[model samples]
Target: MKSLNKVLLGSATLLAAITLAACGKSSSDSTTSDSKTVSGTVKLWVDTTKVPYYKTIVKDFNKEYPDVKVTVTQSPNGSANAKTDVGKDPSKAADVFEVANDQLGSMANQGYINPLSPAATKAVKKNNVAVASEAVTWDGKMYGYPTSQQAQTLYYNKAKLSADDVKTWAGLTAKGVVATDFTNAYNFYPVFLSAGTYLYGKNGETLKGTDANTAAGVAAMTWFAQQKSNKGVMQTSNALNQLKSGNAAATLDGPWDSANIKKILGDDFAVAPYPTINVGGKDVQMQAFLGVGCFAVNSNTATKNQKAAATLAQYVTNKKSQLVVYKHSGAIPVDKAAQASSTVASDPVAKAVITMSQEGYSTIMPKMTQMATFWNLSAPLINGAYTGSIPAAQYQAKLDTFVSAISKAN
Candidate 1:
């Protein structure tokens, strides 16, 4: 791993040399001239698991820009901690780093990452899915190139319930065998979303909590309350163990669980979009919070290296590189062409997620800092609702309080 001192020293030395050369030149003139001859050692941070795929991408990138070299480093914690790591020192941060979409807003707010250059922005728009593209945009500016799309899907035991039987919450509950961590806001959020509840207003750009007091919100809460009595719904610590032991017919989860679930269920393991839930006697398809993986540039990198950093970011997210990532890791490709390819279309999990993305049934996880408060306030409410501590009659009031608290905090 490169130390912060080395990173800062390299950037300072490079910037000082560039400064002397452009002493009499305008910033715009310097930028234009540098773009044509952009060449430098771009430090790239990739998830430890994806380092091999990125190494392959670097090899391919070298074919187009032989003068530029990319140094790939493995980030043990993956993109989840990228914001904090980069924030510690933007000048010392990796020139290019992979991050989850939810980090974009915080990173941009803190000046840790740069806005995408015009060419980079255009490439992202043209190649990636709309939701993936939208997830990387913060305050109307594109910050990163999307690499993959991630969202939870229904993983079930085919022998216990047919595909049709798992389409609705009522139908699945009737089978008397379902398991999920009800306390987890992420796992249970679909119940509220299916009933048209939202965590924020203005398409998640603002932090006005859901109208939990509304008829829709109350109805959703009522249904969640009923789950407590559903003997079929296990409340164990290891829900996956319940499925593995044949005690549960299905579980709500994501692609990351696919490998282990498949190992346990073999040919019986299957995945589909979340089932519809009954809200006020009406069936609505559950909506999942979508997460996107992306690559962003360090805003404080040497000016001469910014264009090269953008080039490298764009290169790794292109269709070809996306296909490589899909092959190595089971991550769903955000590139339209790569997603449409037979390789992706043939995979059941990838196909189901792609369908959900195309149909616009998923919500992008909000990247705003206010989300921290939303999660904190909503978790207790969800737990209370599930355990019957928060009665159905008080669901509205509780939701209202939650919204007010978060609004005030934000």
Candidate 2:
């Protein structure tokens, strides 16, 4: 994956150079004219589920750039596949598209997406949540306009767990109704992350092995094993459904579960940042992996269409459009103004997710391709620890093996 990424980067750099030279004009000059005189059809790709929100955004965008016709299409492959889909055929790529922040590195490295214009960068910094802004930035360059923030939060039944009761793992364990997917590394990662275990170093520029055998990692795994024995942790295929059926008082999950869970729990539904966990008699706050949803311009877009595409991207991510998205999809908006609005302010789930993204000790999901190997290597370790196949006493040895595997993979 690392070698392939380097080849993609080299090819993309050359393509960008050729495209720039062929235009025979500075980006600044093209941007100025493209912003006003440029009038052409611009294509946008969005998740099938989000097509309505994008349609609404396009309607509003057209009012401003009436001459720039915008067509919205659903990306059958989903946002994560945007880079490969675009790279396969630049002419077929949408002028602007929505993608998860982790895809930014691949898209930018492959030149599937364009770097943000100065104005777009400024808007991203000024209006977005800090982590959301940071997620879209690749190698010190901003690539996308952030739209929403994603992270796991503690969703609880207010009837069973009080606001304070959900604040700590020990407290929840005593209540004995909290459940989370113990087998999946993504869902259980907060344990190691909050304990200071990391999957990579140098801001994802390097794939350093984790410290899962350290005191922190062992403590986290021990706590998790205890939960499994007590039935407070679940490895079921239907964790969310179980939570919705009132099988558990609380569950750790991302905002994607909000709509369905909210329908089931209704007024009893509530969310809070991941609680502090007791590890070796010390309290450590659990941290979540953070992600951002954003829109990026296609590098293949015609010079006359770049500014229009950027304009539409900005318009959709702005406070007004984000509010519309929140209303339609229940996604936590990244725009500060939108987040501060009464609708999101009053939504406990939205507030909790935003807080986790900002105040919690959350780690941004690394964009490096090496992350693929980390996920594959970490899953068995997490599962083995949870099922007691890898006992606490043996955690150090297993961790050493895991690290060795990662090094070999690298």
lDDT, candidate 1, at 341: 91
Off by over 4 Å in 1: 1-37, 358-360
After superposition, the stretches of candidate 2 with alpha carbons farther than 4 Å from their true spots are: 1-35, 404-410
Using lDDT as the measure, the top candidate is 1
Would you estimate the TM-scores of all the predictions? 0.88, 0.87
TM-score of 1: 0.88
Give per-model CA RMSD.
6.6, 6.0
Model 1, residue 191: C-alpha shift (Å): 2.2
TM-score of 2: 0.87
lDDT, candidate 1, 229-332, per-residue tens: 98767776677899888899888767666678888889898888877876788878877777788887777767667667766777787788888877877788
Model 1, residue 127: distance off in Å is 1.8
In order of listing, the candidates' clash counts read 0, 0
The whole-model lDDT of each prediction reads: 0.71, 0.70
